[model samples]
Target: MEQQPTADPRGAIETVFRIESPRIIAGVTRIVRDVGIAEELAQDALVAALEQWPRDGVPDNPGAWLMATAKHRAIDLVRRRERYARKLEEVGRDLSLSTPHHVDEPADPDAIDDDLLRLVFTACHPVLSAEARIALTLRLLGGLTTPEIARAYLAPEPTIAQRIVRAKRTLATRGVAFEVPYGPEREARLGSVLEVIYLIFNEGYAATAGDDLLRPALCEDALRLARVLAELMPKESEVHGLVALLELQSSRAAARTGPSGEPVLLKDQNRSRWNRLLIRRGFAALARANAVSTGVPGPYALQAAIAACHAQAYAYEDTDWHQIATLYGLLVTRSPSPVIELNRAVAVSMADGPEPALAIVDTLATEPALRDYHLLPSVRGDLLARLGRTAEARAEFERAALLARNARERALLEERAVGLDRPAAEGPAGTAAVRCGRAGPRSGGQ
Candidate 1:
């Protein structure tokens, strides 16, 4: 029997489409061999649903109905092309587009999973630029609209629109294969895919330039993708590692901001606000990653370990900074990035003292990669203030504020700079005033 019609059919259509669009597009792409065409066909399915669902009543399995509609359209398009015979042979096994009795029979689970994985690899292919990969992945897999993506990244809608269009065209013209690679090639491509997801989460975790410090939707989307990838590749240790890192970092979202949406430094955040469920999930993922490791842990696993350290501490003062600093040392060896080094310095400051950590920061000051990085000056300012150099510390904070793009972060830095002017007895202790930049590794804006 057909389900009763939804009172808000359009709203129901939108909600279902948003959840199922990625699967619909992936299944269609398997048949059409073109993401751009697959997306258009998915939209066509949405149009059909809008016109029919209200009149006929909603289907019991709306997602399957939409997927079936999109897949049938894709088959028809393939049959119309001049090279129908060749294309049909290539995708012949997947051409079983006969109308089902219920119009809601789900596709083979294994096939659908393969199609989704292929779509992830295709969207994150090395052939596309980083920005293009990000825009396209969010569009196809994250089910984000162009305007939503543009707003998330603070870019113009037209620029994002053009970037996505060109990315699809580039993939088609270059004949990028829609399949997961193997061996070393797979390893390299996997890195690209992971990086794209990481970058997306980082942007949401700490917006580079925006009125708000956090974009929770982006974080949710990225976390969803990471979870999907982990399920799809359960044996891949780094996949679990990425999931662990994201889960642990996201657990702090509730306490990262104050009542007015101002930034909350790590030392000041209320630990009770952290999501205990996500923290437990993060720990399980980290354990899975460590269990599967055959050698030294990968960069993500190491980072997850560092995050786990923070989660284990009930209070800021109880945190095991020595272990965190040690993990950063391991991370530096595995990743060897200036940003990682900068993060290590922050951990070192807490583990040892400001003087030793300041020495480490001074060494990085001349590194070209960190010349314009705001955290460099911000971290330095914290150390200087701790060491009784108020004048230099204030100057560093002012410089950091000038370089910061996010309004909230810039205001925080400016506040620190101005606070130095207060009389010694009136002002908070220098150690108390120090901000730790990002609460965790790679979770802050550049």
Candidate 2:
């Protein structure tokens, strides 16, 4: 007789950990009613899989295995407490108590698909402040470790630790539900939820830590989640706007880096490498955002509109800076931010001239928010260079270079300042200045 074949051990192990992470967290949250505890239990399931899968051979249905493992752990814990025992009953009829949701095969994809979304809405629920929600959601749904989350946020590990702990405690004490919102509350929370997701995606698109310039995995994961949200919430215009934004932004990944992983400025980047399909999708989404409006566009829609402005141009010179300046003006009114104003200054420079842009920037020098913002000096340098003020420009560039966290960004800024030290006849500033100036718009992920 032929020997029976075992399931692909590594394949099953990876799939179980990857695809099931979100759903398992969601399912666990329903039972525990505490996202932090649910996440810990989910890790317990992950640990079990890592220990068993390689030895027992991969299960034919790995997601079910992980879910089963988490549920069994829950049952064991709840058996010791009456209150927690009631929790098991609350999660759909004590099947969690007797038998977990796992079976010999995968569950219906459609049925379990909503788990991730539910987890997102719950973790992003308005009960938590913005910082708390983002920290907790990235922990539970993004599958990132607390340390990783800390590194991404540029916050100390202890600070991130405290925030997550406080967030979980708040949720439990307040008895926040682990389900989607309803009625007016649903619409109210949707925008913040979407904003959190987009922020995660952007962090991954351009990493702020380590030696890596891009963390493509995080970006793709975020993009996948956004696409899912767009499909699930098709009626929400901002949902599509976010999806469109991610799709279009990600399309440039291939060309955003040079031969050695150095950053590539937009003007110098090969436009041919950009994905036309994504651009089209982005345009359509902007149109949708417009259609849903009785008045001004939401933040995401306005940002998408701004991104669309860049996408419509075939070349950098062909871009409509005047219209971009106009969009930034509206963006400021809807969402007043120094960062947005900094972005607007770039468009203002291109449309009017360096003088007006410099004046506008000078007005923002005292802004508390822009005090540590490297782009402020970076923008000032570009405008100064445009007006034959190289000495001042060099100082601004050097200041920007010191404040920049990204290695590639700092290198480019230093290079520009060095270049300005040499004498040359004044004309238009180099393509590099224009390119580096664009960094002001994107570097802060504003």
Candidate 3:
């Protein structure tokens, strides 16, 4: 083993691991026929790399190196198992023969993509719970470790680990094929796939419980997956819609946090810091979504349009609230989520007045879904503040701060509650941008 001269080879090892883990896992799963075992082999390769890279100085083509290494491990493991003959027959002779020479038989682009798409569909299989689907997809398709997935979503590590374990067991027990579904089956599973990716991006955009406001790495992972899905299904308007939504929302990454890493509300963020490149990409994606659409806009397309409304507004006051409200109205018909209604209420507040919006929020106050959701009270507090009901607004803000999980958001909510000394509704207009009660359309990058 050649020793690496670099001071920090471990960092390079980690970077390589994150980038190539998904591909390695996908490729190995084809041979192993078990996602869990495939992942173990991939991790084994990473461990080998960590041990050797610092001595061998990272390989010229690290990804290919890792794949070759993982394939060899898979072959060895199967040979040791009692069902070696059955496994060899399943993977066929080509894989077995290539393993001996370490010839690095990286498949063609189309085949590789097919493997990845299969992995995505398998991880997002409807047989798994929604939480399980998200966890498994993040683990298998996003190259995220169980602990990393747990941290990103603010769930307990053991809980996430169990979810991943159970999800893989479920797929195996149900005899879920490691191939993309076709026809109606494909369409049926597509929603869950898109949803898992969306949930990942939302967590990155607005962390649920972390000290930090945003996790850029998670955002990058989600965006990359969305773009891949778009290429894989060019005719799918909703795929394009999802890409558009993520692009538009990500455009504000720079402006979303203050110098001290405090949460910068959309209404208060500096427009100049918004990434123009991402915004343009978002517009192009939205155009593609529209061009491909046959009838009503999909859920993601509608949400993208709403985000576009915010992106195009050079100033918060210039935003077309009425158009947004109309879009929300349309979205409600299509999605009909309480979270959507909360978002619509925000638009209604901006378009009409806080009175009607307050009515809507009051109705949602008792909603089971919104009970532990801090944003519900946060939005209600903002509305109350605007309505000159300082005492009620203060209480709501305090309650919101108590329920909020993220440190930055909790601090912001506490600050708002403490600042109730001023006469109600005396701040600049648009001070309280309508935040969705939960993660849904019209959220500020969430």
Candidate 4:
């Protein structure tokens, strides 16, 4: 009698792929010295697993099984090439002569981590454009299919496919190294890595140009990467800070949308819906960040401090806006970005009143960067409404609606705009407008 496969081996395969694709790709890249080829070999392993795992029982260590299978595929690929002799010599010397073989033993844990770190640095290399780095990193590390990434970012499927293909080719053509940098080089590359992760988290927290209000999967992916990076580089304070900011912000995910998937302002959200566990994690990460810092806070740490203020408040009214404003002031002095100033203005409004914040918003009205920023007008509109200038507030709200890219956000702005014309009981004037800076004219789901 023949042996039977598991009841849902196909499902099991997909689950394993999502969990272990990064490791497989990382390990194979160490073998083949090419990310594109490594990914191809990893996929081949998946195909083999799909064909064989159902017939044979799933392996106890499926990740290790995938890695071994990818290694074999890589070896076959090398042998099939016309330059097999030269390539084998190169691999023999580069990999310390430990040639791969069909064995059930797991690869060295330290080597796996090294490979993963190399893949991370390679995917986020400054040689590639920021957009390319993000798309490729998500595909390689997030284990997201081309279609899945496209759907998440509201991009056409073919565009994302081309982006990933071009990114890999660019890396190969440029002969980018497959290893982490040290000292100055490491610090420089670190910024790009952090930016990539930040972009991912922001896109998930607030969809840039999608009909959906939020994409929790992207947020989860970014958070997982941040946690991994924090573990990989424990001495890096900004990494922990980024993790803290993400955790604190993500705790509000449950309360960020309504039944119809409409945007829910932070003040209007039900505090009970916030995730307590995430809040606790955010606090721990914030503490770790502070512990690792050298007295001066970094960009991520300052932002995390701002988020912490909100997380610590049990109610909207209980929020310590004064402290938040102080933190944002420090952030402004350090980062000196118009966006930071805009956010600080919001904090000022909460701590002081609409008058002072409105003055600050007016100063930024002519700022080239904030000219198209929807949040600027949104904040201005809220201040105008509070100051009894209903007509001006209506105009600002309409302008914000015109600038908003996300359908949900546009609808929210429109709602706020139209409500001003209604009676006091039906108007949104009592509540401040939600200051949203993450969404705008930028493409690819912001």
Candidate 5:
């Protein structure tokens, strides 16, 4: 089937390319064996579509059309490099480039899935720095332009461009394979992939530097990538767990900020604003993760379980703090870090009391990892306020505000500190105290 010709196909071309670029790049990379070149060929295919689609009409399967066009360009590149014969033998019977008519054939779904998985692993390879991996992942898999990514993270456009360029150069120079790894290597690389996605979502959920508290586009990209990974590797429990965690966290996006974009603490947020659909999807994904698990739940699954506890509670007072505390305790054993411990302390405060939780926080005060972490002082301030140590609480809040990088969070912390001096009836009530519990475990590298 062919779409009827339109007066101008540019709009259609742009829309289709944005949706299909990742698949096109992945498919082309399968032939070119270089992601950077694969991206260039995908862009070339888009150029071809812009030049020809208006005259010929948009194809019925625009995605397949773009994929085929990019693959053809990739084949031509390989031929010019004198590697056509070797590449033909390398790809073997799967090589569909022998005839031009093959472009009309729909690509194999299984092959496309494998290629996308390969592209994911390639983009998040360990050879590149974390920032580079994130920049490249957003560019290649998220289909985000350099400026979009730069705006999302509040980095200079040229800096992000340099990071992407350096990342691809590093991946190629290091000879990193495009295929997914196996056994121990697979387990390790899988963590890297999950970490990258988690970091992206965290940055969006609670931006570190920008005036905005939530960058919805970054969150959407991370969620989309997680969902795709869940489909591509259905058997991986942590993958599903990652999907679940992100879905549940995203459900609260609507309620996380006030009318004027101020940070809303968990206790004060309107639960009615939560996205029930995302919560249900999160629950389903969590069930899938649990169903496929052979041993103990992974870090992400445990965190999702904690989030589920909050989702189940209609009111802040109804939340199952004990269950959340138990899950965080288990998470600590699996993925021990100062951050997890701090999160666990928050849950413990809710379930037990502030006194014991403060003891936990005090012990962690000496840990170098938490020294610069603003949340540590933020949590400590909350605990101190709960225990009626108003002056100390105000000091801690001031310190946290000073340490915070995000303007919104800094303002919230400053308000908390100032509110401590107000009369009991006028003071900010439970808002600041429940911030940590509602925010969930910052385990994904906040």
Candidate 6:
């Protein structure tokens, strides 16, 4: 057993686990032939390292060490079962009980790609249901813990845990192969997988709960996964679309939160904070998506265009709201929803005036979908404020504040309501950038 190095072995273990766990699990599943059992074996390997590495010093190749440890567990699992001989035969090995416990097999790194892709496909299989596939894939492939998955979805830990359990059982019982789909079946399954990845990124970019507005870890993880998938499936235009959308959205993460972690509205945030490199990459990906087909823009590619408009503008005042409004119009027709319509109304408000936007929002007031959505009222309130309907705007602000779950968002809305009755605090046009009771977007990078 090798020991971890002097530089905090636990920290080293944690980092290595995050980077290497997926590969280890994928590799181990090949030897054990059961993803559920393979995960158990991989966990055992991690436990072994936590105990042995501190005393023996880190191995030159930590990943290889972990892989080897996991292999030992697989061997033990096979040997302990009455079906050991049968399993050995299945693996194309000698079934003699007297034979050495160590399995005979050549290391094949190139085969890892097929195995990993298979694992992803299996985890994202339609058989497991959308939410189940997402939770299972994130747990196994995204290097995310069950708790992490629970937190990401705003679900209880036990609920996430149960979903994972059932998902894996369903895969095992159905004998789902760890392989990519081909033809129409492939196209359909791939779409579901892409949707999962998109949802993961969206949740991270705007967390549903907790005090913090963003979870960069989830966003980065999703981006990394999408980028890898894009490379693995280069011929698919939508893969590139998803990758492009994520990278572009992630670029704005730095600008989304203020010094004290308050939300920053799009038009008010500092454009200088956006990552230029990501913007260029997004544009290139969008171009590739466009060149791939003459079909109407897919959801991701269309959304990328919207993001591009914001990314290109050097300043808030210079933004082309009219083009954005037009794009949103196209988006609503192509993919109609209250969310898109609400967003379009915002653009309309900026392009036309509060009156038209209010009318659009008012139409949605009877919509069951937007009935509980705080953003609807928030948008309505902003439009009303712009229209000089102080009394209604103030009421709407208070309603939005009550509807919001995030403390920071609720506080911001409350402040807006309070300000309606009071004078604006001394500052620039962009409301006071409150921190932990402080002010402004901290350029100091707090």
Candidate number with greatest TM-score? 3
Query: Which ten-residue region of model 5 has the weakest summed lDDT?
Result: 437-446
What overall lDDT goes with each candidate model? 0.77, 0.69, 0.77, 0.74, 0.77, 0.69
Model 6 Cα lDDT, one tens digit per residue, 115-168: 666677778877888878888877776666786666445467798999999998
Is 4 or 5 the stronger prediction by TM-score? 4
List model 3 lDDT by residue over 275-352, tens digit each. Answer: 999999999999999999999999899889988998899988788889888988998889876777888888888888
Tens digits of lDDT, candidate 2, 67-139: 8778777766766665665665576552333233225655445545456667777877777887788888777
Alpha carbon lDDT at 431, candidate 5? 31
TM-scores for all candidates: the values are: 0.68, 0.74, 0.76, 0.69, 0.67, 0.70
Task: Give the residue spans of candidate 2 off by over 4 A.
Answer: 1-31, 41-113, 138-163, 422-446
lDDT of the structure predicted as candidate 3:
0.77
How big is the positional error of residue 430 in model 1, measured in Å on the Cα after superposition?
A: 11
Give the worst 10-residue stretch by lDDT in candidate 1: 427-436
C-alpha RMSD between model 6 and the true structure: 7.8
Compared with the true structure, what per-residue lDDT tens digits does model 1 show for residues 402-433? 87777888888898889777643211222222
Error of 3 at 235 (Å): 2.0
lDDT of 4: 0.74
Q: List RMSD in Å for every model shown.
A: 7.1, 6.2, 5.3, 7.4, 7.5, 7.8
* Residue 58, model 3, lDDT: 70
Which of the two, 3 or 5, has more TM-score? Answer: 3
Q: After superposition, how far is residue 213 of candidate 1 from its true place, in Å?
A: 1.1
| Pairs in clash, predicted candidate 2 | none
